[model samples]
Each structure stands twice: as structure tokens, then as C-alpha cells.
Target: MPAVIVNIQGPYTERDRKLYAFLVHAVWDELGVKRIHELPVARINKVFEEHHSDTSQGWIWESAKRLAMTSVEWAQVEGEDRLHGIAHLFSYAATHEAARADGVLKFEFPAGLIPVLKEPRRFARLRIHFLIALSGKYAVTLYEILESVANLRNPVLEIELTKLRQWLKVPEDKLDRYVDLKRFVLEPGIRQINMNPEGAGFSAQMEALKSGKAVERIRFVIQKLDTRVALEKQIKPRLEPPVPPPVEPMSAFGILLSTRTYEKAKQAAPDFDIYGLEAEWRDWIKGKPRPNDPDAAFVGFCRKRQRRMEVG
Candidate 1:
């Protein structure tokens, strides 16, 4: 449900996104506790290592100024209590002599937005590292939307082309054609999302649906590419399913292994490459019939490898 209407009056650039992400990460833990937060500029600079130097107080202040200039029409009518007024994205973005010395940035959101900010449940479950790793507005925005539902069983997201364009903040004067939008924004965004160094935790793609000849909707399909197979597939290609046995140990390749598995795996292998050994074990189990308790089997594989190494 749409709750608020925001009319922006300034450009939302990559730097703006960086500062926004920094603010989100900085204030995440203190949502309901504090209205104002002081962000350490050096720490934020570290997150965006390529951008600002240790003394880049000037750079952060510029971004903060942009945010202050951007205003939102924060109007809410709850029963008889109506809040109707124009407000900036942040209530106050101020700096002092102490801010320069301490290398900090002080800011606060409009009080009316507190209810929205406090409800983390509606926010996407994303890491600040993953978010900042993405460059460009489209790629970052696309990732946030896709990742929100990526954990759902074989998730797919569909939105009107107009709405998608608006969500991506595609300028009205540019990329008017569907082909152009797909070529410039959708494809490149998907590539960057898939290739991000931090890893998006899932893979994604966009599909265009048409209404009689004109494209009208965009469909985004995503899969939860869990770490196990993401690691194992590079080492070995999974083939046809093995005939049903009890199940081999550590055969749960696509699923995340429990800490219990990791502990035992470490104990069995000791100094062995646990992950690589896991891949080798997975490869060895091919076409073999095995026990149902496959989780413990991985430890057994390591122990056997240890014994062989000991003897030789």
C-alpha cells in the first residue's frame, strides 16, 4: 500500500545513493532509539573506498547538501489528525567545527517518517556491503526489488513497464523506447547484479511482456542461488540424480550446511581444505547409493582421507 507521496526537486545521483545507503546502515540498529545519529565520515568512506579520502569531509558535506535540497511532500491524514506539509528528505543535515575534527556527519529524518523507518519488516533484507558494491541507480534499485522476494520459492516479480521505469528513476526525456530501456538499463543492470563482487546472493534476469505489439510489463525472475551449489558447481557439475539410497553424507549440496556440520567437518579434516574436500566428496558420491544421514557422511569422508594421508 502506498502511504506517502514524495515530490523530489533534485538529481539523485550515485553519490546520493552512496550516502543514502550509508545512512541506512548507520542508523539501522538505532531506528526507534534515536532521532538523530552522528555518522563517522571515515567509516563511511571506508565502505566506499574508491570515493572519499580520510579527510573528505567536503565530499560528504556536498552529498548532505543535495539531500537537504531534495524535499518531500510529507502529508498524512490519520482519522482527523492530518499532517500536510513540504519537508526535506532529512530534517536537518548539519555540520560543525567538531564534525570536521571528529570526521562525522550529523543528520535526522522527518519525525513523521519514524513509523515507516521503524518497521524494518517492510524493508528489504539487504547488506550495506552488497548494496554499495552496485554502481548506477538502475542496478542498485533493480537489485533491491529483486532481492526482496528472492528467498521465496522460485520467485518471480512482475510490474508495469511504466511503474518499473518510474521505480528505476529513468528520466522521462531519455530511453523512451522499450528496446532502449532493455538494452541500456535492464540488461546492464542484470549483468552488474550477477557479477557484483560482494555477490547479490541470487541471480536475476528481466523478461518483457507485450500488449498486442507494444511492451507493457516487465517480469523479473530470480532464484535463491544458495552458497553450497554456488561453490560446488564451480568445482563440479551436478548431473542426473543418483538412484535412491538412504542418502549420502553431505549430499545436501544445494542447502546451507548447519554450523554442526561445519564443526564436525573441521574436526574430521583438521587442517584439510574443508570446502574443497566437500566438493571432492560430492564428486566422489556420484552414482553411489548411500545412507540417509548424509550430513554426517561428509565428516566420514574427511576422516577416511585423514587416515589415508596418515598411512601414506
Candidate 2:
């Protein structure tokens, strides 16, 4: 729960990531005392619900298999110096058939790998609730890396750009340019992390280390938020009256009209009244099948209508 093993990979899918994180939490309390942990399939599913509000048997089984097969490699400064192996996620998995039937899941971790999670020299402590709602892998990765160092006196984590990319699991070809990485990856990841309702609890800014105009190291200046201020903001909003939610449309045409598709239609045919066009479209689609992509279909109809009016 507190430490993250660095230079780890795989658990690529969202479900897989959540499953691995849940396993870490499950074993956290019993880290040193026990090598094996058993969790009821119901409880594991509950963990998913606590975060995501839903789960299925197929997803659980797939995630379990993925975790069991995943490998983690790391370098040791002393003694062996380097280590690598498959199925390093756990030493044993005995939940094959039972897991499918909603039974218990039993996991046994490798002895040496236990301490990597159990007793890390440096690690990030984060609220599991905050992590649950995060949709992007990059957001989760950056949050963990930054949160790990948030408690330090300096609260600044500086790493080489290459190493940062590796930690982020960025492919070599993607975001190859520094500007592109900052624009697409770094900014969006930080934005998503900070946008959480409970507050991301930290702010990050990237500083470039330049050697004769060539950027090298990236310094992440992380600052922890003051809890008092965050709490005040949360409380102040409750005093106001709750606003009513937007009305949802029932029919396909209504759905399209209520969406940004309506705005696009207006733009494509500025002189054409959207209300009248909606009526025309509703009539045009009468006795016909509904479109799978109503928004696109609406736009196409509007363009055709605009062209016909021009010809007339």
C-alpha cells in the first residue's frame, strides 16, 4: 500500500492494473508475517466495486491469469546484482476452477519479491479511492511516482528523461519529441491526476535540465496540498442548493439534437433553422431503422438538406 516496486512492467490493461493494485492492498497488512494470502472471490469482486462499481466472472478470471503470468525484473546493488523471472507476480496460484465458480483466490508470493513491496526504501503512499477512478495508465503511473516522493523535505523528484519514459512505460516511437511528450503525455496525465474531486493532493511542474540548449534531465517539482484548504473547499460547496441534472432524451433523433452534433449541423447550415431541420430529419427517418451513430447520421442529413436548399 505504501511502496511501489520500480522498473516493473506488464499488467497492461485497466482491469489487470486494478487487479494487481488490489492484490498489493490485500497483502499489505500481512506483508512480513505471511507469504501466502487467500481472498474470497466475492471480496476481490467487492474491491472492484468499491473502485469501479462493477465486475464480471470473465474479467476476474482473465485478470487472475494475467497477474499469475506477469514477470518483474530488477537489479540488486549488492550480492546477485541482477534478477529476472516469469510468473514473478506470485509463487503459486491455486484459484483456477474455484475462481471461475466465485470461490476463494489463493496466492503465494516469492520470498525475495515480498520485501520489494513490503519494505521499500522509497515508496509512494496514495489513497486507493483516488486511484480507483483514474482512467488512464499514465495518470496512475505519474501519481504513484510523484506521491512516493511527496513526503520528502524537498518534495522534488529529478530523473533523466529516458528513465522517466521507462517508468511511464512509454514506447520508443511514441512521443519521441520533447514538446510532443510535454503536450500530449505529461500535461494530460498531470491534468487527469489533479482533476479528481477529492483533490489529487499534489501539483507537478516539469523543469528542463539543459546542456547547451539540449534538454537532458527533467525535474518534477511536486508540492503537497494543504489539507485544511482542500477540506474547506469541499465543505463550502455543500451550503449551496443542489443543481438539477440535465434532461436525457428518449429517441435517437432527440439524442442527436441534444448533442454537439446539433451545433455542428447549425455551423454547416447557418441559415437553416435547426428546429425545422430536426422536424425534417424526424420525418425522413420515419418507418426506417435507427442509425448506430445517430450524431454522424444527423450531420450527414443536415449537409444533404443544406445542399438541396442551395440547388432549389
Candidate 3:
């Protein structure tokens, strides 16, 4: 009888964590190994491929028939999601007792194994929830992974590589920043948080980053033909007409008087109607109200100015 070992790697995503746990749980039952043995995933992958030679190293697993197993599929226990973390599981055809009798592998785990391997899915979920808690950011890609594998029938021999690829892809913006921070935050000897942004934690941190301003203010607002385009993804504003400035009676009177003066001057002498007249008058008044007799005053002033020009 022969025995196999599984190795789990760190820096694993939520999907990987869940898959690893399910694999170990399912295989532990199949091989009659009651306990999990903690080991390095790189080593397990290397050794497993060396013997089986059927499954690809660190990649797709053909059907269980290929591995001489009864069934092969992603296994879900009560609550779990796929691609939450990365782990490798090995299924030995022989029982641990049988293997131990053969003097190859032990039946028990490297003491305190349940503490490490009991809940891979929980670990993965915690990682994501924590990241969102601290950074006030989320990788849409990771969320999609949790959604992908929450419900599955089998776990030991069947895992989907396609789903794994999709899960591992870190979204563009978060990917760059996440890789840089993983070195400091996730490294050993660093005091770090477990679940991020519990309750309003992420929102509060995000609000703080805004320096007491709305996120909408930072986003671009573009008015285009047909429809307005907001480059930043946010909820669309409510449909309402923009409020126009208040119209004043004085301003209206000044405009009417100016029009009348222009008309009279054009009839008297046909040429360019005074350019900048409205602007100049408006500026002099400083947005003040025009006199009630503005029209009469304009006529009298124009006549006086005309006589003076003729005399000169």
C-alpha cells in the first residue's frame, strides 16, 4: 500500500483556499486518512506528478477514471466557494493504516493539522473580506470566484482549471498595488488584520481618503450628444432640468432700452450698431437695476451727444 501527501501554498487566493480544503477533506475520506498532513504545495505537486505521470503538474486534472478513482469533481461542504485560495491534495489508493503498515507514510497528521486544514474555505473568505475591509477596494475578479464555486457536489478528484485561471487574474488597478503591498502586509512578523473593513470600516476609510468630499466630485462628468457619459462608474444622477439663473426686472429693462436705442440710431444713421454697448453698460452698472426712465434718458443723452459730435 502507498500513501500520498498534499501541500498548500501561501499567498493563495480565496478560490485556491477553498479548493485545497475540499480536496483534502474529500481525499482524506477516500484514502481512509482521518487527519491532514501539512506540507509545501510545490513539493506535493512535484512528488505526485513524479509517480502518477497522468495529471499535469500544477494544472488540469483529467477525469477520476484516469486516476483510478470512483468520482472526480469539486466538493463543497455545507458552505464554501471556489478559488478562494490555492492548495494541492493527493489521493492515495491505499488507506493510511495500510500505508503505515507498509512503512511508507504515517496515519496521523503532523501534530495540530486540523487547526491548519479544517477550514480552507473560511481562510479564503477571510482574506478577501479583510482586504476589502482595510483597502476600501475590491477585486471584482475575486468576488466572481466566490460566486463560482459556492455550490458543488464533488471535491476530491474534479476541479476546474478554467475557473481557477479566471479567479487568479487580479484586476488591473488593484493588481499592481496589491502585489506591492503583499510584501509588507502579508509577510511574516508583520502585525496585520484578519477581516478588513468590518461594518463601515472600508467605507469610513474611503470617506477619509476623500478628505471630506464625495467620490462623485473626483469623477469626470462629460456632456455629450444624445447621452451624458460618466467615465467613472457610478450611479446615474436623477433626471432633472438644471436651474437657470434668476431674471431681474432691472436687467430686463436695460436690455429693452438698449434695443430701442440701437433701433433709433440705426434709423438715423445706418452703420455698425454700437458693439460692446450692452457689455460696457452692464459693467458700469455692476449688475445693478437700471432707472425706470432709462429709455427716455437714453434718447435725451443720445441727442445731446450727437449735437456735441456735430459741433466738434
Q: Candidate 3 — worst ten consecutive residues by lDDT sum?
A: 199-208
Question: What's the best-to-worst order under TM-score?
Answer: 1, 2, 3
Model 1: per-residue Cα lDDT at residue 312: 88
lDDT per residue (tens digit) for residues 269-306 in model 1: 67565655665675676446654666777788889978
Winner on lDDT between 2 and 3 is 2
**How accurate locally is residue 6 in candidate 2, as Cα lDDT from 0 to 100?**
49
Alpha-carbon runs more than 4 Å astray in model 3: 1-19, 27-33, 36-110, 116-312
List TM-score per model, in order.
0.62, 0.62, 0.19
- Which candidate should be chosen as best, given TM-score against the real structure? 1
lDDT winner between candidates 1 and 2? 1
Candidate 1 vs 3: which has more TM-score: 1
Report the C-alpha lDDT of model 2 over 1-312, residue by residue, as the tens digit.
333344656656656665666567545545556677777777666645755545676566676667777676654454544444323776776775634646777777777776665444222244444565676777777776777776676889888888888878788899888888888778887787666423455677778897788778889887665642343344444434334335432232222232356568878776565544554565455334667776687788889878887999
**Local lDDT at 176 for model 3:** 46
Give the alpha-carbon lDDT of every model.
0.64, 0.62, 0.29
Clashes of 2: 1
The residue-level lDDT of candidate 1 at 183 comes to 87
